[model samples]
Target: MLRKAFMRVFSAHPIETIAACTGLFMIVLGVALGTQHGWVWFWGQVSAVFGASLATLAVVWTVRMRTTETRVAANIDVLARQLETSISQIHKSVKSGRDEQLPPSVYLAQLEQCIDNLIGVSHELGEITGRPMPYDVIEMMTTRHTLQIEAHLAEGKPAPERRLVTETDSCPSCKQTVEFQIGNQPGDSAKPTCEHCGQRFHAHRSTSGSIFLRLPGASQFTRAVSVSCPVCASKIPANIDQAKQHSEARFCFSCGAKVSIDPVSHACTLISKQDKLAGRFDAAGVFHCEKCGEPASVLTSNINGTFGICRKDDALVVLPAAAAQGSPKTDAA
Candidate 1:
């Protein structure tokens, strides 16, 4: 216990402890000799020892303060150099990104790297200054940049095939199925008024390309539907809410055929085979040359169906299918 107490006090104030102990030892020696040397001599010795102890303490404290200041200044210099290096690296990265025509995704990734470097510097600064780093601005900047990149990428790509289809959603107020027409564009939106309750609701495309209807302070919902591909007979999953205000094109995954869905009739029609490039049938049931847009005459009929063939300038066009019946027939050359 004694040793622990002594160590605690000595570790906290070693110079003061040593000085005080030396003075106490001298006083004790003086007390022992006071009986022979008298009280006046003992008091004189005590004053001298006390003054010396105070002088020693002052000198030690000044030296310690100077040493601590020097160490802190050295640390600060090292930290300053490190910070300069980090900033230089950040500038180089920014310049490189500006000089190169990088894709939006690549540019955003580099920007994120720069942000991470800045965050590291912020952490270092916080450690030195004992203050919390303000990260809200950084977060906001990151989010803004990410959104801009996303918008740029979206605009660069071709718009998805748009088709008008009827969508059904339950009205929050009336609890009845509300039917409306919408486009299949992924981000397209509409405002629909409920017929049953006259309540207005906001409708928009979800990330999965389905139409979602939502009322104020209410959850969103969608109507699911499935259709079979006319060419391959494979089931195609779709959301009715994704139908557009006009006819749009869709590709069948199973047979690679471009299929068109009638918005009003909900019928799937074969447009063209994606791989074959054999041309498409028009709305009027007339087969046309894929390259020249000229109506192709039926070259022959078979058990499969009627095949149309046409010549565009020097190129001969062969269509995969012809009108069901009454198509113009041509003699084989």
Candidate 2:
């Protein structure tokens, strides 16, 4: 309480305090020189000493004011840099779509704290120097923060569960079961690859199961026609990535027929077939001739030496096993 009162008075009457101190010092000097000097000389000496003391006080006050200004300016610069860095980080998080690193609420809290500190420093600087600080960046960040908060609040509500649509189909080339997951979007199709033959295809069907068809061309073509081999009438798999390089004509394994496709109309036509391409199944072990589409027991090994047949056309075919050969390891998924 006493210190506050003293400070209040000191700030209020600084000139008066300096004048009193100078007057007291002048009087002491006059008394010391009274024996040698007359009253007129004493008065002259007192005036000179008082003027010197006032000059010294003026110099000291100027130095202290300059020092205070320097420190305040440095502090403001530091605060401005900190504010810039914080805003840059916020902009990066928004730009790169990496906001998941920090949740919206948590990031908002951090930005609010930084803005508060910046505003406080700006206010202090404005009051001390009587100059307005540039706060356009702060205002922009505050506006963005407000918009983000509103978006979060509006979208944060719970939503109803959507019915999941799934379709299961068999691959025409390998007869592998292919399951597709259709999302809630309208006209959306699922592209599933066959694990058995590595063939990829898109499955599009209505919820009512009324419209079901395999796209004739690649995925890029808006128009699709149902494709079947002219000889064996087997379905074929093709996609955009495959069509870009070249149109792949499918060879029917069931009938040993070479197929050709019309790129514009997506029509399938059997070009030719060699009888020698078909191989007869004589062995007991399962054999899969992709060219002949022969159904036999599953072959366990990929090495032809284990169990394989050479065609009359001198073509060696590597077949995948359809099932395990009564082995525990082969049966494990």
Best by TM-score: 1
Model 2 TM-score, 2 decimals: 0.29
Per-residue lDDT of model 1, residues 234-312, tens digit only: 9754333222343444555445566776554567888776543354445433456677788654332223343343434
Mark the regions of model 2 whose C-alpha exceeds 4 Å error after superposition. Answer: 1-40, 98-114, 131-145, 151-333
Q: Residue 302 lDDT in model 1?
A: 27
Residue 61 miss distance in model 2 (angstroms)? 1.2
lDDT of 1: 0.53
**Cα distance off (Å), candidate 1, residue 296:** 50
The best candidate in terms of lDDT? 1
Q: Which ten contiguous residues of candidate 2 have the minimum total lDDT?
A: 324-333
lDDT to native, each model: 0.53, 0.46
TM-scores for all candidates: the values are 0.30, 0.29
